[model samples]
Target: MTTTREAPEPVTDVELVVLLDEGGSPIGTAPKADVHTDATPFHLAFSCHLLDDEGRMLVTRRALGKRAWPGVWTNACCGHPAPGEHMETAVQRRVRQELGVDITALELALPDFEYRAVDASGIVEHERCPVYIARVDGELRPDPDETVEWQWVEPERLLAGVRATPWAFSPWLVLQAEQLPLLAGAA
Candidate 1:
């Protein structure tokens, strides 16, 4: 088994959010001067669409102990952009943070986009996100702090799971899945 380094401390300033083009590659990083104290401006994140040999996507039931969407079912891996970090760097970092595993390979996802939402429970500043797809064959160990449980299921099964447990995932995940074609396969 390969061990990963600890993720660096996050840079909360909006300016610290690294910049990426629609393809989730580094176009440039935000300048510190452009950073805002109110909310993370670039709030860059990476999430992978993991498909195993059987075409089943590995989904995780975020530990009910997560700060954002606890017990929510999300794509294989996800996490935020750290200061002075690039998209690729964040991708590896997050995979290790959420699930005790490092990605073997990652491919960019389609229709890269951003959105905003607020609930009484908490406010998210994920103005922009860069999605990815990683193929792996390793044991997954959910960090008690980040995720509670995880599983591998077919895409249709995941959709049903979401419907049965709406609050179990971030709203954006559901919307993103809808935008994707059912047959869409990722690298």
Candidate 2:
């Protein structure tokens, strides 16, 4: 007698973000797409600053189609950690997705980097974003949906530019530079 076997159904993955309370405690999870709006709630996210062997930082311009901070230059990558996802894992995943490159020497630079900003279009971004620094390990191939343009520049020069014209870059980048020792000033 011959028996017929059925194939297992494919599982669908819905991207979810961890929502945080005022005290930075994980409260619950929400769909990533629904979390960002005029009243974006506090969510767990991360920002990564990529550097080459010579210490030049990689910066990218946010795509014009982004809902928040479109067309503005910012750090190498930023992303929200999925529900139950590790912060380091999320950073690695996002850098690969956005810049098409892998990174090493990942270090948590700002563990309590939280910010809330309102874009000109009234879109709000409220995140408990931890900042990271990593060294690039592969060739860059930025995704058009995430990055329109990219360049590597000295961290000090980048800091000077952001300081001189804060309006030209992402609010988070400006805020991070102010707190990060590596970009604070020439040592």
Candidate 3:
């Protein structure tokens, strides 16, 4: 972990992300900005699906200011953990940061989900984003800088909407939907 001024510095895309080899072992690190070039390199990332007690899953729209896939509806949250950071710890922190909610348990639905996508602006996203399902039965106060809109919908309805308007959602979310069965046993 990098430190500065007697305290842990803030984690931002301006910092670095952990890279992985074909075997999923940490190989090295690269500045977040440099990792998403035209030829994006594979990096470690995560996606979280927040479900309410009523079986409604939360979905959020990426802030318009986002450099990639802005205004697109996606899973509850997505973020990258720094090198040596545990995935669960990262997800917990991200949920609190992005959704203003706290969670204690996480069920990893897709441990090997990976994808490479290039947005219209040409920025690329090549990541090994493991998907996790978490239950949150409370209001969502999303960070305006990270998410523009948020809502809860039944899993089946969300899947149907995404299929009916596939272009309205993120590519990874579409892929993640196909693997929803992995979350069948989740609460």
Candidate 4:
């Protein structure tokens, strides 16, 4: 007789997100899973765009099971840093968690990149998201629960696609692509 065991699942509960005031002050903390609602509280978050040596940007299609924005393509990764955590540290951790890549160094390309978006399911995301850009390369091993597909894309081409089919991507991804022209020397 033989037996099989499954890998321990990552904990989703009790993950803390730093609540923020209008000016981006950390006012309080809330569980990550409960933070996004029709009336989402403003929170501090970060989005990371990874560029390879060839200058291709990494993008991922959100898994269909995502409650907020299912099957929509977005940046390499994004997440809220725990209260009092550095954005750089959070980005490094998240990139490893979501994309299975180690990010040695990263930079805040757009510190004032904030967005308020409501998905079709009525879940709201009101985040003070500082966009970070990193140049990294590795064999991508995306978490099946988080991503359904992945790709490397040219920045200019990505911008054109976002303009042509805006609805096909997450709101934040579209916004990021729009700001690509301003991200000189990011790669």
C-alpha TM-score for every candidate: 0.69, 0.93, 0.87, 0.88
Off by over 4 Å in 1: 1-42, 163-167, 182-187
Candidate 4 per-residue C-alpha lDDT over 1-187 given as tens digits, one digit per residue, 9 for 90 to 100: 9999998967765789999999888899999888999999999999998988887888899988988898999888999898778888989988888888887558788788889999998999999999988877578888888888999988777777778899998899888776754333332
Best to worst by lDDT, what's the order?
A: 2, 3, 4, 1
Residue 52 Cα positional deviation in candidate 3, in Å, after optimal superposition: 0.8
**Best candidate according to TM-score:** 2
lDDT agreement with native, every candidate: 0.64, 0.93, 0.86, 0.85
Clashes of each: 5, 0, 0, 0
- Candidate 4 lDDT score at position 174: 82
- Residues 47-87 of candidate 3 have per-residue lDDT tens digits of 99988877788889999998899999999999999788899
List model 2 lDDT by residue over 1-187, tens digit each: 9999898956658788999999999999998888889999998999999999999999999999998999999999999998788999999999999999999999999999999999999888999999999999989999999999999999889988998999999999989989987898632
How far is 128's C-alpha from truth in model 3 (Å)?
0.7
Tell me the spans in candidate 4 whose CA falls farther than 4 Å from its real position.
1-13, 181-187
Model 2 TM-score relative to the real fold: 0.93
User: Candidate 3, which ten residues in sequence have the lowest lDDT sum?
Assistant: 178-187
